[model samples]
Target: MKNKDPKANFGIELDESIQIDGVSATATKFGESFRGIFRWQQSFFKLVWKQAIIYYIIYVSITLFYSFALDSGNQANFDAITSYLARYTSSLPVVLLLGFFTSTALNRWFSIMASMPGTNRPIALYVASLKEDAADGCARVDLYIRYVLLMWLLTFRIVCKPLRKRYPSLMSIQAAGFLRDHERLLLEKHKEQPGGSSKTFPLVVYDWLNILLRDTCQKGYFSVANDFGRNIDAIQVLKKGGGNVIKFASKNVPVALIQAVTLAIYCYGVVSVLSHQIEKHYLTSVLSGYFPLPYALPFFFYYAWLKVGRIAIDPFGSDEDDIDILNIFDCHINGAMRLRNCYGVKITIPSTDRSAFSLS
Candidate 1:
């Protein structure tokens, strides 16, 4: 048998990004925690290895510069500066800031993911309202589902760089079957309006979706339209979630806090190596200045921790650590398209009594 794409199990197509799912699905034993430690995709090592290498290179260059380049007089001044930095670095609260920021980012990221609007609710609403839909209802269902998904893409395109890659322009999305040609002409007209459109054209898609939905609903084609309030609720959730993502990523993370933490980590590393220069003084400790092991630990920890926060804030980005937005889109496309394919109700059960049936 041919090997299947792992994501197909989730009813999604190949996302062409990273896949971290199913790595530990069967690792139920206590010792199995390490099952995915070495996997290149979505590994912590994968996320931070490039930065780690650059850090070590810079640290080593600074170390060599200190040990060999400086004259005795300049070396003494350098030592003084490093000592001063090392002394005050203790007050920076690097750990506290990192811990708080990372925890908060992680919590918000989870919320964004949970609140990501999926078509499941809309699909359920369709099923509830029109189990035996008319032909016109089916056409409306097709249009409604497409519009819902288009709205998601429109909003996500505001924040998600990857989705923009898939649908670079609203015209591209339209050509790909997401919008009607008339809708395309309407968007174009909107784009040419007073003051010219925003550099980002997709922002108008929200307004378009709003107008499209209102007009479509006005015809009263839906048999039982009350359930559609549920779809509206889902759209509200999507917009709110998108707004949170934008606000948290761009505005929530305090710039000063980040700068302080970054300076602390880098400054600590450079000063730490110089301060512990055992070769210059009488050395006793096995791990001294030349042995970067001491500084390496904290540097790696803080740097990697900060990167986790960076990836957490923009979960829709191109990074391997980003959440799979395409999966949700696929669920909408493949599953929601079957909204009008419902069959007659099947309520039959076995006629045999439970007591009469043999356990064997």
Candidate 2:
């Protein structure tokens, strides 16, 4: 039997207690950050304070006008006006509509993300299935794999505005070592004219991949049924993903729906402020003392919720809250490099252009 000393047991219990304390401290820190009122001052709100200022100015103007300037002596008149507005448009239904709209936008954002394939398992599977006995086979294999990855990058570059900005031209992509000089020349020559490089480059890469698969199958490097066929299907899957990404990028939430919901929120904020003013002027003195409090709290929450919904409406843009397209591209390139390393292949593309160094 293993020795079970009382002192050792006590030491183990003490270590567990210390770990629990650390976990509790972490939980407390998280709660403070998440529930902090100042959290709103930290995000995109910090960069664009003017818009927030306008909102608060309008709200404060209403409060000031009603609390002191408006005929507080005629409480019945103010009550009638606010009560009529509230009866015509209730805030609760508008809030419910906003919640539904936000949920819809969130669902679309998730669907777009799901459509964009980020993992390289299919690429690795295709590469690992191949076998080559001919001399310079590894070099050819490396070229094929690189072309596949470069095609993926180009596809995303077309769909993502930020990535397109990063590699604005074929020459820039070539300089990044993602495309060789001859390949760039070939792609340029194949262009019907001197435009549409983004769309044409992916097609060129697809053609090259198809040719490579044909040659490999004919040379007995791998069976068409087992490897080449599967790779073709995998390429089609990637193509479908690219198509879906483009479709999502091209489409958006109906402009009418967004405008309607936004209008409702703003109207509710105005009516709510009016309602609170009516209560302060006519209600009990105790409640009247916290006049702006009631108006401010609901307005702030409503504005924050609407802002979040707007951000979700287009999650692929250049906004601070949008998806990080560059980071996703980096994951693809890194995974491709890792796959090359796993196959014990070493290859280098000569950097003929130094201008891309700045682009990097």
Candidate 3:
């Protein structure tokens, strides 16, 4: 995150050049909310006001131009025409369209959030259902759980920008104890091979888990038929969740729908403000002369809602308003480690053919 204070800043402030003023908090820390409308750093104000400024300027200019040019009688006639237009144009259809579009965008956001695996629940189940009490059995089970946790984190790392930032590269991931050095080297090697497009890393983790499960079953860890089936089912649940995340991440909200919504909002904003200005010219003329900021309130609200909906439609980006993906992964990792450590199990990869599972 970048600081907004001029004293802490080195470069020219673009907003200053534009003559758009804002009250920036010099000492506001991460996760602190600057939420109220009075605070210039509020998301609604920051996102909405910049665009609203343009329309406001247009409204004031138009009002002033008319006020000076028109006589009292002609001004009344012009107001009548605009009032008539307002009656037809400022109807409920615009609101209905905005409502539907915003609802759809919100649904898309929740859908992506819901697609993530409930890793803690599945992890608790795995820990509770461990049939083997022996040291080697516990270690193998811990290793498998660690792989599952790693796979989930890797899935998020690919789709979520915040997690990608935290684990910038394979080396960072290796340093974080999620990937062994050999594993990172192997992934890097696969990445260097250049004939075809690279496969996503989560799928590689998925394949490795499947191989681990089969091998462990063969080695008599999950010896009982019911236990093996149940364990496999748990793994499948995790795999399905990961698949859902990947599917959603690869796809995007329909562009046509987004454009339609955006077009409607801005166009309606223009129409609504224009109509209001003409219909209430006498009141607006006075306000424009005495206090210009009051004229911008309705538009500020309208633009803010539209801007909020647009931001909500895609919540996986690196913006401050986005979903906290890095913290979620950190929680999952901590939970997995705690569960494994409680059973005194060491979670190291076995020295088998580890080269085959490559994330690169």
What lDDT score goes with residue 208 in model 2? Answer: 87
Question: What lDDT tens digits, residue by residue, belong to model 3 across residues 1-360?
Answer: 111132321222111222323433442865334423365543566786567667777777767766788888987876776577567664636567667777877887778767667565555555655554544767675667667877787777667777777778877777766678887776667667764112456666667777876776666655465665676777778777777877776776678877776776676666655555443457755775434465456556666777777777667776656775655555555566556655535478777776677775
The TM-score measured for candidate 2 stands at: 0.73
Model 1 alpha-carbon miss at residue 173, Å:
0.6
> Candidate 2, residues 36-117: lDDT per residue as tens digits?
3344533545544564566566656655566677675555677678678767555356777788889888888878877875
In order of appearance, the predictions have TM-scores of: 0.74, 0.73, 0.70
**Model 2, global lDDT:** 0.66
Q: Each model's number of backbone clashes?
A: 0, 0, 0
Please give the CA lDDT of all the candidate structures.
Answer: 0.63, 0.66, 0.63
lDDT per residue as tens, model 1, 52-111:
677667666766786679888887887777677667656666788788788977887877
Best by lDDT: 2
TM-score of 1: 0.74
The weakest ten consecutive residues by lDDT in model 2 span 9-18
Off by over 4 Å in 2: 1-53, 67-79, 89-93, 189-197, 223-225, 278-291, 344-360
Summing lDDT over every window of 10 consecutive residues in candidate 3, give the lowest-scoring window: 1-10
